[model samples]
Target: MTLGFVMLVHTAFDRAEQVARHWAAAGCPVVIHVDGKVTRKVFRGFRDRFAGDPLIRFSRRVRVEWGTWSLVAATQVATERLLQTFPDVRHVYLASGSCMPLRPIPELCAYLDANPDTDFIESVTTDEATWTIDGLEAERFTLRFPFSWRKRRKLFDRYTEVQRKLGVRRKIPEAVRPHLGSQWWCLTRTTLQAILTAPDRAEIDAYFSKVWIPDESYFQSLVRNHARRIESRSLTLSKFDVQGKPHIFYDDHLQLLERSDCFVARKIWPQANGLYDTFLAADRPSRRVAEPNPGKIDRVFSRANGRRAVGRPGLYNQGRFPRQGFENGITAARYNVFCGFDDLFDGFGAWLARRIGGRVHGRLFHPDGARFAGAERVFNGCLSDNPTLRDYRPEQFLTNLLWSTRSERQTFQYHPGDTPEVVDFIARDPNATICVITGAWAVPLHLSDLSFADMRAEAARLQRADAAMTATLQSAGTAARLHHWTLADFVAQPRDRMRGIMHEITGPGPRRVTDLPPMRDLTGFPAFLEQLRNDGMKPVVMGDFTATPGGRNGR
Candidate 1:
């Protein structure tokens, strides 16, 4: 599939050239539009850099301003230029000079080829309660922001407040229903053509020209109203803070960038420590192992029916404090541990196994085979017998599992025909206590290395899976005592406390607490813990352990 890129850039001309060159090397047409406000020398420099390249073109300069229609105008000019210049272009991607490709160009091409009819754009109906931007929807669509507000922010603010008090508002065209989304998107050529050639294009443009931040809503509204085939997901991944400014990716965000499924990531500061080099180097093929085969398990479980099967109660030990009723039977404890990326869970599970003098089974789930391999070595060597490591994509697997269940009750009832072997294993193991540990509600496994936007999107899916699994366990009436752990518990502890816990689990050897990779974000951990508690599951804090073979005390 032939691809075309429209980059809207205002600064960092050198970095913009690098971006153009990278895409050009990938055999894709690149069209850049420099803001009209930039110096003539800046435009000349960019022109001279790509003077010899026919595939690289520049759009007519437009004086772009933030929170205005100028940004939309610039994007339109560049997109039209790209379409006119490359008749064979199948898809048009909108990006910025600071955006970097997260995956190889060939991989992106392969994905597009596999889904040619899909328009990778994020679009949400503005009127929906979920489409929130702190009341910007009403203010933006209803008010006229015709001037450059940045030039006199205080004056414009006062004027807007006065206008609001006066009840002055613009009438939205009857045919238009405002939609909003990320300004960046990758759309099919057919969709773009329809948008540019729409009979009401002039009317639509005129109406949005006076609206605030029209770029964010213009294309989304048009596509949602007119496109035949649209996928409400952007190919570009970006993170925005509360202030609405895009997160500037630095060296620290490399792991996240490498693990993201997005084709491109935005707001990367080229001047950051090795940031440009890191991404450029990643453009090469990865050295990780191939993913595991899920088909083998699928083939085996496809013949069973959806009937509920009764199973015996599983053995469960509540650690040192085995609730009053189970004090005498603690020795017969059998545990099944499920964890995402943290090795601490595996270590704690091993400790539990030793404490109860029972068998332990560890299961490591991730989409990346390499991550699974690393987790297997850590958990199996430190805890149970060769822990099962499988290259499983949680989003895909959980989605299928949820769909296979009969929705009459909130239970984990799997249809035999559609259930995977792993689910069946958990269901049939009536004697094992189940422990599920994840970074947070959004980050189930370390393999879920996704962009911030992707993580937010996946959080809802993860919540659904969690609910479904909880219900399934409840419906089966298994004796398995369920314990849920979130990374927040680990983060809430003092550094020294975490060190002691790590020493307790890892057993004082070559591996040190500092040697482990740093945890990404722990902001969501506490809330996730509360969620588990709200769901009626007792979550054991990782920092409360006082007994360790290594003789380290946890506070």
Candidate 2:
């Protein structure tokens, strides 16, 4: 028994010629089908290169387009010519111009000779097919696609929508169970003859001509009836991405392809010199005779598919800026936000950084500028502290900060005086750990050397902002870990709150908390609250301020 090959050539003429010569040298007959899109002069020149070999023949040309009947038509003409010209050939393998033979041709022939009667083609029913894209599975067989999805996409879509609206579905040909699979296959001569001469050949051809991407379905569906024995899997190794596009093998994929142990692999890069040279070497090292197992490299492709679909966490680029609610994650790592602690204590950021063993920044969203750690003008990833840039896209600013320093835990101060819109984003992020000391903003206002009227008005505005943020943090759908306390309540038992905050930040452990940071003096804070109330603005969320020492000793 002899094996024949029908290779569909479109692009990469040089590579195609090299592959054709390789196949001819292996004592196998090759039939080449060059796309009509190539100029006649170029086609003649390519054909003339193989003029010396009698085993190599060129078939009639056809203009092939993606997702159209032309590809299938091209294949049909090539296969018919090969079968008619090669009298002793019993099996025909279909491959593309970009395909490369991975194993020795003798090994492939021996494998085929063992199963001369079985057809190696993927044939899965439409209901069982999960690889179809754009919501067209069974609809592909029923709908008439007269326009090209590649060149005339808008018209094609409009026509499809019109048909859907008008409920116009083409009737499937009788006795034909529509199936889908990869366009590549290896079929026995008997099965090919049977399908070509079937009584309903004209009807099947006409029906499939209007089906979308008919090349993937025409032979696959027809083989179900004519093939005496079907393995239902292609011998060629091919993998597609999440977007339904084939993965091109590059020079880096040399080992990855070898691990598959398949006879052939498709869609190799034209410039991948390493793969072509290594795989096409005449005296290549012999591999063990084992069944083709593409599953060996399936895990690598699966990971690549996931990276293309979901993307890496906290990373955003032009190609994969996912739609809203589709982000893999909002931030790279967990970080802490101290809402009012900076105002109520001296050197709180430094003190907290020491306790939690993490970097801490003061008022990252402050109107003046982002107060990065150590007062640096620029921090990780060259992120500047310019107020305008940070405020332009506060959410991206925070995300970038967290992503750059993801190796260590981060803590930053936040206040009602900062960016108000960022509060909602923080509340929604599961990676945020927010600690709110409510009404502590009043301490800074009271300490400032401003008129009583100015202090009262500023206090009211800040209170409103903080109140809105508090509602967002305490909402039913909040995902961040929130720890809120009234100013008076926190000072009443400062030690316990500090200990609890440390535990939450560092996680549960038996670590002891001995020395606490000193708190700012609140010598006339109660009177200050009374003054604000008397001036027509009530001090709410403060929880009854009183003159008392609640720092370090909690007394």
Candidate 3:
């Protein structure tokens, strides 16, 4: 009724020897399988190191390539050797060189003795298996994977595509309903022997040899036919990341592993001296009563997987530069984009800063330089107001600004006359709050002392820019909160519009805006628009305005 181990050793020979000797000392027989790819000199040295132990034996080497039949071949040879060489072993525990025993050997032996007939292996139907990676679920069983996924990835992908296009699926044997799980398992000798000596073993092996990553499915699938009672879970704890790569446990994961209560854990870092020293110690405590529950530490791995996959929102790094429209968020926090507001109202940035209680910057995309709130050359995160740097990657500059000042609401003026490079980005960003007073750029042109000809040409250019910006804001795909007001429409009820804008920025509050910012004189604003129209440069975004009889548009 004693336990036996079959270790699949490919790397970390020194650590493998240490673990093998430890198991031998605890009276459990072990069969070692060194990968054929290992150099003869290294294999001979590794074999010699374990020669003194009678409980240890080496199986025939197999050249193992990941996601190919070689891995299954290696495991088959090692597992068959273990069953034959150690007849007294009732349950054969399959492990890897990097796997370390988390619990004392006596406790694991006793636990297996309690469930002597129960085979502990994770065998679930493909539909039930959530752990499969790379979009290959049942396809791994049906499709042929001749190319090495690790070495010849392009060939593997192309071959898989060709198979799919040609509808070339391998016929799975009628007895074998494909089941996938962790490659590691612990099975009773009866079940293991039945599988190795099944009447149709040759046919099953031939079919699976062409299956993708057969090591995970071969024993996992056959156990159904031979096993008396299946627990449908592995005693060995192994975790894979979002990319289907094993999570390597380092020294820091010592406590994390202990919490799992699993008998063995694999993919340990060779440099994890703390784990080896503590777990392999002679006096390691035995927890016979506790059930193996890797779920205790699942949250930690789940969070790690999430961070690696989705990453933090609005934070771009070399590893996770998300594709467009796939970013968690385009900007870090909510910010304001005031288009044409500055021209319509005097000292708008300062006024908005008082109303919203946040930093208010003026013309951040201005061609001259960023007109920061205090006219400072340098801002948060040492961001320069230089037009060249800002224009080089305007979206990045805006994102950096929001990321740096995430603690406060950011309000910045953006006119069509300024750089319109970041306009589309802001429109797509859900964090942006855009308040536009369309055609307010005309107010600034009306105040300028430029010649009529100069004014007309500049007006046309600004109008074109404004039209583009408005189209983006009004588009069906825009995510930004838009508050668009025509120049004439806004001037009619400036106070009401300002209050609404302030409320949206600051959310609902008791403190009302007692007074509105003073509006610039529009005495000849209508004449200015009429003059532009007469000169054949239409200012249509301004909305129709009627001249006041008092010689000025009333404040």
Q: Estimate each model's TM-score.
A: 0.52, 0.93, 0.88
Q: Which ten residues in a row have the lowest lDDT in candidate 3?
A: 546-555
Q: Rate the local accuracy (lDDT) of all candidates.
A: 0.60, 0.89, 0.87
Please tell me which predicted candidate would have the highest lDDT against the true structure: 2
lDDT of 3: 0.87
By TM-score, the best candidate is 2
Expressed as tens digits, the lDDT of each residue in 366-446 for candidate 2 is 999999999999999789999999999899899889989999888999998899889988998999999999899998788
Which of candidates 1 and 3 reaches a greater TM-score? 3
Question: Candidate 1, TM-score vs. the true structure?
Answer: 0.52
Q: Which 10-residue span in candidate 2 carries the lowest summed lDDT?
A: 546-555
Model 1 weakest 10-residue run by lDDT: 304-313
Candidate 3, residue 412: how far the Cα is off, in Å: 1.4
Model 1 pairs in collision: 314-430, 411-471, 411-472, 412-471, 412-472
What TM-score does model 3 achieve against the real structure?
0.88
Spell out the clash pairs found in candidate 2.
Answer: none
Off by over 4 Å in 3: 127-131, 135-175, 251-255, 272-278, 281-284, 303-307, 373-382, 448-457, 530-536, 547-555
Q: Tens digits of per-residue lDDT for model 3 on 100-169?
A: 9999999999998889899999898987657677558788888888778779989999999999999987
Candidates arranged by TM-score, highest first: 2, 3, 1
- Which wins on lDDT, candidate 1 or candidate 3? 3
